[model samples]
Target: MARKKSPTLTEAELRLMEVLWQRGEATVAEVVEALPKRLALAYSTVLTTMRILEQKGYVRHTEEGRAYVYHPLIDRNQARRSAVQYVVSRFFNNSPELLMLNILENEAIDADELERLKAMIKNAQEDGSEQL
Candidate 1:
């Protein structure tokens, strides 16, 4: 059976969205150009991906001359939050603490980064807001 389409951005779609987020708006050709050299996606591929993003409500396009200039409907932070929530739901079993613990155990976090994380945790504790 065919897999269902996910609302979350795929890797290719995220790459395209990153270009749109950075540039504010861009044509398919421009997005193709902005992508990493190693990605080597064709203009047609970028075009199709942008259309998919539009259908997913992540982007919108306007007719600019002969080309469609696509703009991100969602901001970078919104995308990040959604992606994190999806990860927390799927792999972390709806437990953000498990996600944090997994990262802390496996990842090599430096002292400065650890301090920053601690500060953020402290702030969160002070606020007493567990609504994630």
Candidate 2:
């Protein structure tokens, strides 16, 4: 199988990956069941999406009786870090601090999150920060 290099997943694909990340492993029917009602996805839609993800090497399947159990091939944190890097590169002129600043300014981050953010920044500064 050919591995995709830095493939940007579609919204539906990301949603399926989200389910896989949350559940660790699930069947096609289980993924469809977990999808938000607003999506109005059919069972076939989930099945096809899972197959596509499997093809992309982001998801893998195992036989569990008659059903195929799917699990994420990548770690959740790594994907998030990849996505954050993608956004920073594509939208923020490859600057991570700008991305963090924009997020702090826009999103309704609560006090605890703000503290966590501060702690991260502090840790970064103390450790010479991560390279963008």
Q: What residue pairs clash in candidate 1, if any at all?
A: none
Clashing pairs in 2: none
In model 1, which runs have C-alpha deviations exceeding 4 angstroms?
A: 129-132
lDDT of 1 by residue, 16-100 (tens): 9899989999999889889999978888888888888998999999998998999999998998899899999999999999999
- Locate the minimum summed-lDDT window of 10 residues in model 2: 3-12
TM-score of every model?
0.87, 0.71
**Per-residue C-alpha lDDT of model 2 across residues 5-94, encoded as one tens digit per residue:** 446677889999999899999999999999899999999989998998898788999999999999899977877777778888999999
| Most accurate candidate by TM-score | 1
lDDT of 1 at 105: 100
